[model samples]
Target chain A: MTSDAAPAAPTNPGLGALFVGFLTISIQAFGGVLPWARRVIVERRGWLSPAEFTDMLSLCQFLPGPNMINLAVALGVRFRGIPGAIAAFAGLIGVPMVIVLLLVTLYEGIGPSPAVDDTLGAIAAAAAGLMIATTAKIAEPFFRARDWRAILIAAIGFLAVGIFRWPLLWVLFVLAPLGVAAYWRWRR
Target chain B: MGAYGQLIAHFAVLSLLAVGGVPTVIPEMHRHAVDVAGWLSDTEFTNLFAIAQGAPGPNMTIVTLIGWHVTGLGGALVATAAFCVPCCVLTYFVFQLWNRWRDRPWRVAVQAGLSAVTIGIVAAGALVIAIAADTNLARFAITLATAALAWWTRLNPLWALGAAGVIGALGFA
Candidate 1:
């Protein structure tokens, strides 16, 4: 089955458009980048349809490294090959990388101060809350579907890495294959 | 190998293993950078993570900050590139092949399994950071409240973060 709904989708976003599109995403990505990336690529730019966006995102998520970075590369390559990949990657990372480094410099210059420590401490707590919310959102779908195998795998993962303080490499080595096999059998 | 080379090699391995994204590899990074390499204190590690989370951009910024902490600009550049390039290259080559096999039953199983495990790993990361961050009852309460707000509401999390900062400045949390 052909994937495209229509054979002649008129847009092959130029490298410049890819760069500028991702640049906008990077600048506005204060807490998380995915939503912004979706808004820009799927909605604002009309580069990928909603289904295509989800499909691309799932692929990016499945592959290793930072999902968003992989997303930029995949999208870039999908549109315009290796050079496009580089352009999208550079655009997505460039301005924000500089800003983050600058922040680090300023933070270093501040040295160790009580007020700064307090502020950072509180911020860290809130950031953790954000992470918790993120996990809940991701897990919600499986929970809703009563997917016990997935839930069990998740619980094992949490215990192994979160509570036991095990090395992640060993944990993944043991868990990944078993999880995959379990899922495969369950699907049959 | 030189420091940059070592950093690259270490992160390149981490890059591949970073299934689900940077957060999945964070505990490992923390273990190496803080516990193993002794590059930073526990406080510094968590603080830098907070800063990265607060700042604009992708979650990769935390990796960049860690590199910057270790060896200034050059380290940051090297670490970011090393973490990104190998995996991006892998994605570049694999995406087309993967799409062709979209209907494979094994592929679906793999995705489902990996995603569940990834969620679990991310949850573990949240617990690690929460323990590090919630030093007092007030701060702990703030974390719980923020979690609820973020989980249930459509509000942008930046607002919660800002309010938490304000509470900290006022010495309430």
Candidate 2:
């Protein structure tokens, strides 16, 4: 794992290459795109190391919009500037948007069959579990570093958002600065 | 404004407010689409969420579906672009700034702080979806089983999702 202290040298893929890379990632991803993205960018393309991918993902998660969308933009801009970012973003989302629209049309035609409802219900349940697992995976680094303060911050955040149903913006506003300050103090 | 115009304006604000990604805005999306705007019913909102989850690519496609419900193909395009473009531009500029200050102490602090908050936000997102979807005991079991499988094993999530779908189709869950 590469530490945040030192990042790997850039692979500097071209705009066309980024388009193709993201296109493949979008096609290959079924339920979730993040795992496939990691495989393609880190292992297959060598655009980023595992540690660098983790670092980038952390930033992407913090930003607004889809994490993968933010990732595509950041990676694209990193290599080839704004046009590169557009290429990556378009490749990532264009076809998938069409596919999703088609699926929605089909679903509407099918209407409310009990079997379809059941299938969708089970899928939703599983998706919820997948979200939980994703959270655990993202939190693995903190556990490994024994970062108790970070864990406490995460707990507070979960309580505020999940239990209390506080406005997300307010929760982030309150927790983010406090978290930053705490970590900074600990480092000092 | 027209429906298309309303969708663009509404989702554009949602685009920036999506802190931990699209799911974090589910409650707000529900509020707008179901309660405030009267565009979709409660059942429709939940169903759209499920459809987006089951579809390929990003789950944020729910926004596109909502736009489609409001108008048609053009609405889908408008909603998706409005929801994605602003944030993409922001990320592009921020990435340049981040790279320049990669080794700064405050950057490190910000990263650490934000990561923890992100985890919490995601967890909350999961909880919200679980409450909405797990309406029965069998569904709850499926959720728990899948979560355990994902956490304890290296199994592909698609396989778990498929198996659960089969169970549901069979009228078991």
TM-score of chain B of each: 0.69, 0.78
Clashing pairs in 2: none
Write one digit per residue (lDDT tens) for candidate 1, span A1-188: 12123334547899999899999989866556765675567545778875466557656766789989999999999889898999999999999999988887887788667786687678778877876766675566678889899899989999999999787667776887888899998889
* DockQ (Cα-based) for each candidate: 0.49, 0.56
Estimate candidate 1's alpha-carbon lDDT, on a 0 to 1 scale: 0.80
Interface RMSD of each: 5.2, 3.4
For TM-score, the strongest prediction is: 2
Model 1, docking class: acceptable
TM-score of each: 0.74, 0.82
Q: What is the lDDT of candidate 2?
A: 0.81
RMSD of each: 5.7, 4.1
lDDT of each: 0.80, 0.81
